[model samples]
Target: MTARSTQNKRKRFDPVLLLVLLLIVFLTGLLVQVILATDYLGSGLGDDVARFQDLSGVESPVTAVLLNFRGYDTLLEVMVLLMAVVGVWSLTRAPFPKKPIEPGPIQLAVVRLLAPLMVLFSFYLVWQGSHLAGGAFQGGAVLGGACVLMLVSELPWLKNISSRFLRIGLLSGPLVFLGVAILCIVLQGTLLDYPQEWVGTLLLLIETACAVSIGLTLACLFAGGRPKDDLSGGRKR
Candidate 1:
């Protein structure tokens, strides 16, 4: 009976494995078809973007597309980051170290030096984004890296950060973006359609706010939960 059971089990193919194999084969065929239908010599939308690039308020085509041409998509992406942090906070409390560990002099020195510099560099990236390859996401990533460095060093001040401040930082990006969109609708009867004269300023404003929020959101995600003050019933464990 045991031998029969083993044989039957061995003979049964895994449905999941079969499904995965089918999917792989389908995708491979689709990829081949797409490759065969490729237009390698196409200029694509470069000319269209260039023709309107001056009106985008930023010299970088990528930035113009991300923050101006398709601002709604960027708005949704920022909201997604905020929602991710909210979901994480809802699920668990930040796993902060109960007992703070003192860092070595070298580690402390490095963090102190690099954290500030990284912050400055992040802002520079935000500024450069207007005319170059840098932008809010890159700047925010750098800022988040700096925060992670401080967290790893177990900075006492970081633990004491007010929940209100954190919440404000996390919400600022989406709120500002939504506000701009609504304002555009009110003024121009279209969402995110900045006035020609104000396009540059508005894009900058959005990028700055988004960079700050993205930085905070990323840091909060790294912390893995809500700050103590944000806990229910004002409880702290």
Candidate 2:
């Protein structure tokens, strides 16, 4: 009876176990750092960190490092998000009738006006991503917000999106990125290495495509849809 009880007992939260796991992760990464010793002075305003004055003479290292040096980490982040979509689909039976998420009056009015401007702003940011502050991920996030606003409205705008289309949207970002990477490898010596004059153009194109796909993904997530009606004719109710 005692053996059976122990076997059937629920696993309790163990802080010691959590700490040991974290220690293992830190130690593994620390060993890699010790072996490589390779770093950019990208550490910020925190303690023992170099300031902008210290980092002078270098061009916009943040932007360059993000898109170039840290590209793999960013790529993995996108993958994690893609996986979340699959997890959600598997966990929930979607296209169940939805109630609008609903917003307060002032919030609703603000979102109504800001939505279009935000989209334009996101595009501008993505355009600048190749050189300046933003990139495909940031642009996609803003586009996602626009879709959220629509879903939260008293009148939903996405009444016709099929789940199949949503599945497409979810996969689009990775597929496009993979295609570009493969193309670059075939045409050039490296994957996703921008050719002459093609750097900004390619980045902008990818960002634009990502923004729309993100919007669609957000819309589908919020709508829970394989919607039945024509949503193209959507108007405020």
Q: Provide the TM-score for each candidate, comma-separated.
A: 0.90, 0.60
Tens digits of lDDT, candidate 2, 1-237: 123334546864466766888999999999998868856575553333224312222123454454444545655666677776665555444453456555678887887798889889878777777556676667777888877776666445455456566667777776776676677788787876656456545545555666666666665566553345423244322
Pairs of residues clashing in candidate 1? none
* Weakest lDDT window of 10 consecutive positions for candidate 1: 1-10
Q: What is the alpha-carbon lDDT for the whole of candidate 2?
A: 0.61
Please report the candidate that would top lDDT against the real structure. 1
In the range 81-146, model 1's lDDT, one tens digit per residue, is 999999988887788787878899999999989999999999999999999999999999999999
lDDT of 1 at 100: 79
The C-alpha lDDT values of all candidates are 0.91, 0.61
Q: Pick the candidate with the highest TM-score.
A: 1
Error of 1 at 34 (Å): 1.4
